[model samples]
Target: MHRFLLKLSSCSLRNSKFQRLILPSLNLFASGSPPPPSANPYSADSFRKSRAFSSKSRALGVRCISSEAGREAIEYDVVIIGAGPAGLSAAIRLKQLCQEKNTDLSVCVVEKGAEVGGHIVSGNVFEPLALDELLPHWRQEQAPIEVAASSDKFWFLTKDRAIPLPSPFDNKGNYVISLSQLVRWLGGKAEELGIEIYPGFSASEVLYDASDKVVGIATKEMGISKDGSKKETFQPGVDIKGRVTLFAEGCRGSLSEKIIKKYKLREEVNAQHQTYALGIKEVWEIDESKHNPGEVVHTLGWPLDPKTYGGSFLYHMNDRQVALGLVVALNYKNPFLNPYEEFQKLKHHPAIKSILEGGTVLQYGARTLNEGGFQV
Candidate 1:
């Protein structure tokens, strides 16, 4: 029954040392191979020409070869910070443009997770409009987009009763999906398009040019002891420089946060601080007879008070599986409020209990969501 929306704000970073440079539109897809600094529009020369950059004495060059710290380096036309949905999609689209124009554009995606989707946690009721635009033949390609959403129900719960309400969620053509599985599939597609995906390699720092523009990122150094001494397996992080760098690391990503702070991205007029919510989710294998694929039930006004902004979701997925979760606003006044305990209590309610009575817990995880409405 909750509305899902993405709000993007335009911002500029103008200071005595840093010039006002507009964030390049995501819609702009460059073609051809990586070019020299003077030939590249995203380079320092062009930044100065556009009056978007000021000189600095960092002594960092355009090309990222081996560093003084003995870290190896690689160059690409585009470098993506995350291998999640946004990062993979961007890499795929860039490669698609390369194919269409018969050009060679090297793209790289760095993921901190052990695998492509290992860290992704979601109560995903997926709408495929973007997928349709990116890959029109996704269904034909046997993508894991099974279990079309068929029914939606909303409930107002009390201590002992479950009252039906007019459902605000209409997921007629959407799909109940495991977001992690889908992300892995998207990773495969990205690889097929020749996008280099480096899993298990966390980006530790954003590499910048002498003009303070982001050139790429440096991966985290591995095999360090607690005392900060190098172990036998010590391997220096690699420097990945690119003509254009994209930070697709979801909301509140480490590197992304650094960039936001460095550029003062949220200093725009009348900006509101970003709010958050903790989403605790679990996948259960329910009894075959009790399973109903594509049945989505949302509940409100039971575990949480009327003043609190939060709800619960129970999505019936394929293979007699059910995915349920509780979202609790992090800004709650009560210091004693425990989201995990609240979720356990939510499962005991008559409405939710009946469905999950004979179910076995398969997997569970928790993650944070951006809840600052129309301010992100």
Candidate 2:
């Protein structure tokens, strides 16, 4: 799914047919600026009215102050939410087009994390094809992509033994990587291409004009108490106006989910229901003698019953570090089943315990993911 998003975003800028298919849904304007009110759904008067007198603004006690008295507004040709691979790729592609055409295009990316890669977590056995297309010289740029996968191992685990299976995992040319590190590297490249990135700013609301066309986003206000009172340090969120707004909030992102429902994005997909999975992952530093830097392992049929649709992955990465994780389908029938506890049980299996008995855990995290590939 990550690869697919990256591929589409990297090529979406100059592809007119693709733009015609997707840009209208995203409310994007052409030629790096919005069209006049006569040709566009948005009007200057309606934009101001929506901002100053919308129901939400009224509920929040936002006054109809003059432009000079309201929160500061920054305008851009494009505004991207989330600094993940997809968003950064789109921003970089737009800037590249600007350089090639000798035209100016303003681009802005907002990330909720304190830093570019702080919120990213994945078991990333990475396929480098997308990266190769996005930046062919990434190898020369010193990207943190090391530890090429050397082999694949798949097993069917019993309580006491691991029976080797005909390995379906074919990671011969992939890499076991820290996805956060790679995303940070991409963020640096985006900045080098003159893209403006604002980390630590969470996009709280999707801004729309009177005609219901998306115009931009509003950042979350700070210094608001849990009881809904403004603190002494209260400050209103800034309004980021853009000709086009891209939401790359990743799997099940809050705003993305809202947008999807609002637009019935999945209604046309033959009524295919979205499925989710809970992924629990851990990184460990193991003894040098026991470490195999490029070995990849995947297992099935233990800890989770046959009825549950789930699996586990263990990848040997660089620096004597091993990344392991368990994915459990959210549709499990057992109401009392805990995914984290199940992961703990998985590590105790004979096949997994041998490698981890003497290791030290470095990091642990869990996140929900889109289960059945990239849908809608």
lDDT of 2 by residue, 1-376 (tens): 2363210000012223222211222222231243344432222222233323334323323333323327666666788999888888888888877789987666778888766777777777888888888788998977878889998999998899999989876777888788777777787788667566766678888878888888888777777899999887566776777888999998778888788788788875755677888888888889898899889899989999999999998988887988889999999999998999999999999889999989998888878878774464
Q: Write the per-residue lDDT of candidate 1 for residues 149-187, one digit (tens) a residue.
A: 999999898977889999988888898888777777787
Local accuracy by lDDT, each model: 0.72, 0.73
**Residue pairs in clash, model 2:** none
lDDT of 2: 0.73
- Report how far residue 190 has shifted in candidate 2, in Å: 0.5
Which portions of model 2 show Cα errors greater than 4 Å? 1-69, 268-271, 373-376
Worst 10 residues of 2 by lDDT: 5-14
Question: What's model 2's TM-score?
Answer: 0.82
